[model samples]
Target: MSDNITSNNPSLEDVIAEAVRSGLALVHTSLPGVVVSYDSSTQLAMVQPIVRFRRRSTSTGSLETYIPPPIPNVPVVWPAAAGGALTLGMVPGDQGQLMWAERSTDEWRKTGAADCDPRDTRRHDYGDAVFVPGGRGADDPLPADAYHATATVLYGATDVLLGDSTATDKVALEPDVQGQLDALAAVFNAWIVVPNDGGGALKAALGVLTAGGWPTITGATKVKAK
Candidate 1:
């Protein structure tokens, strides 16, 4: 009877393997994706999964084809804590990772409540995905800075905003520093007396120093800081 069962169900192991694969396919988790679109105001994105799902081709049963659907209304993850948040400019075509919530996020997403119950019973659904930017491939590596290396926060290809300041102040960088220095130099240059003038040497020197509106630090308008 045992021999007959073994002969009759020779593909039992294959059936079990297929069942495991099918079960794993139902589990929604994290995967690399590309940004289709992002709304900065809402902090939500539409992402297309980079990794494709393999399915048997309808035309050819022996061949497998790839399927990648774009996920809509996914929240973009920002670095936030203690009342401060760091946001990135995620444009279309930017690479990222999509991580799905363990439970339904519909209630929490709408209310932003700490103790909200799931509106739906769906667990690990793709609709609850959150996008985290900067998931780059090995081919598309981050360029290292000469001085700061990988520690630098880069804006575009050239500009870099280094430090942050209090709400009232800004951490001035680059051309602003040069402009301030130039203004200071102008003030100092004015104090050099030219030996003879209509007034005394002291008065002439003082007049030159105050020629440019009391030697104020003027115009450094294009200053941007983190």
Candidate 2:
């Protein structure tokens, strides 16, 4: 299966992120077969089809504008001005963090916070220090075959990741947990086993860590770990 977040290329990442960001809620759609209601507190609207728009560049970035293209696809979800242009790329937030936005009044206005998707399967993190427990010296690395069953069970690692496209669903571990996993890899006999999904795997692993014991994660019951 193709991993959604399997690349570290910034350009490619932007494309995937754009695809996900374009998912507007199907709310309050008069379109047939898309029955949804809108709340007054909500502001997202569907893009009015067939609206002519032109793209422009801002001092900071670029976006498409429909302000002069103003027209209503419907009453509840009116496009800003003409039709607020969608941001050509991500935007920066008030705090200067990268953000996602929708068009409003000839401007790309952000209704909420946006951040980069840091998940990438083709990346590996080799921490500063090596984990070579009981080795002859700091320089003598452990053999890949030397890790025993006890070590594997203790660290919960049974597979090795080569840090490539094949290493799908890599986990972005928290600092403390990452340290533990790094050290564990030295003794656990191979590269650490990561979850085959997104942050949910990290969350589940965190649950196990906070559970005060090594636990079997049969289902989603392990996501509550602190």
Candidate 3:
């Protein structure tokens, strides 16, 4: 009446055949398959402990004993001297430092992207996100003469510059860039003009940010009130 040869229980011959088949299957199978998915047709399921049985001698056979390959050095887009003196540029060890405008006589004036601390004048580093072309790596070489539409010191809008006066024949940055810089000035000047409180700070910062007048800080870096 039933399709199974042993409806109530598996006979001794069926048990022996299954054991032999499982033993043979173990020889040519991955470790995951054996450990993760093991289902027997029998009602009484018996889970076997994984054993370290190697047929051939090898230096590193087990996963725990395996040695991974070393990681390669990642590349970056660094600024270099291009027919001019060093300015607004990132050199060997200049990681968390940048130069931007501050309304001071010696704050910022486009020279060269490779320039560092130009003319004994110190520029304030804004904690906002900045975007300048020409940090391209070996795979991506900078064009003979390239220029970016907007250039603002990042993490914050403390200063703004076009990287180089040669980028375009303009004294200032793009209109939107100029507006953000102005908004930054307004926000900063509010402290000088108005009282340095929550209301004043938010009014200035949000005005610029909401109107797409602020440089973005992508990645894990978070923006906070200065």
Candidate 4:
């Protein structure tokens, strides 16, 4: 008997379709409380989760430490407007201090116990830091191996529509929504993974939806419910 196992018959299209379908199904099964939709006319799939943020505040005589409300549920899609033109790239693990540079123009001028001496200025640069828990000296640049790649996805109009309502409309939209979600998850899994370098993957994923004839995503400004 031959050791090889052969199916009676299978078409290439069937195999490819099954693969895509299986990938989408796996993602849906893994993430709960999330709604997915697909628009066949546009060939787009959308994934979103219901989330709420509560305003919270506390006063301490002179200083206040404010922490934004936690995201109760992970959003199915990250909004593009929240962070302009998302890019995925590698950064040193110890470069967390530099990440805030985009938030403030004078970030380097801010004084802290870590920034004491004028000659010590060289020590504050990202190159001077070590990613390890503890290291010998400040001049020892951390290994580039400590770097990591980040993944980002821009949000579309569909996400905004889903976030605005949690009504029966959501249920009505479920079937289409789920289709999109499955498509997105399929593309994401195939392309987005560890070790960084996901730009190509993201582009491919977005292309799948755009080519499908979905509405051009636009006007993503945040809105408050009346």
* Alpha-carbon RMSD, each predicted model: 6.3, 27.4, 27.1, 32.0
Off by over 4 Å in 4: 1-172, 192-198, 215-226
Candidate 4: tens digits of C-alpha lDDT, residues 50-71? 2322221233212223322221
The TM-scores of all predictions, comma-separated, are 0.70, 0.13, 0.14, 0.18
How many clashes in each candidate? 0, 7, 14, 14
Return the number of clashes found in candidate 2: 7
Per-residue lDDT tens digits for candidate 1, residues 1-226, read 1211224354776667656766766678999999999998899889999997765455654335476689999999889877677766578999988998999999999999889988689888878899999899999877653336457544444332334432323445556667656766765666556556644665655576568565354432333454
Model 2 over residues 1-226: C-alpha lDDT tens digits?
Answer: 2323334554666666645544432111211111122223343222222223333345534455553221222123222354432111111110111111121221112222254333332222111111111213335545656577556521222433333224444344366465666544544453355667665655555665657553322322112221
- In order, the Cα lDDT scores of the candidates are 0.71, 0.32, 0.34, 0.34
Best by lDDT: 1
Which residue segments of model 2 deviate by more than 4 Å?
1-11, 23-61, 68-226
Superior by lDDT: candidate 1 or candidate 4: 1
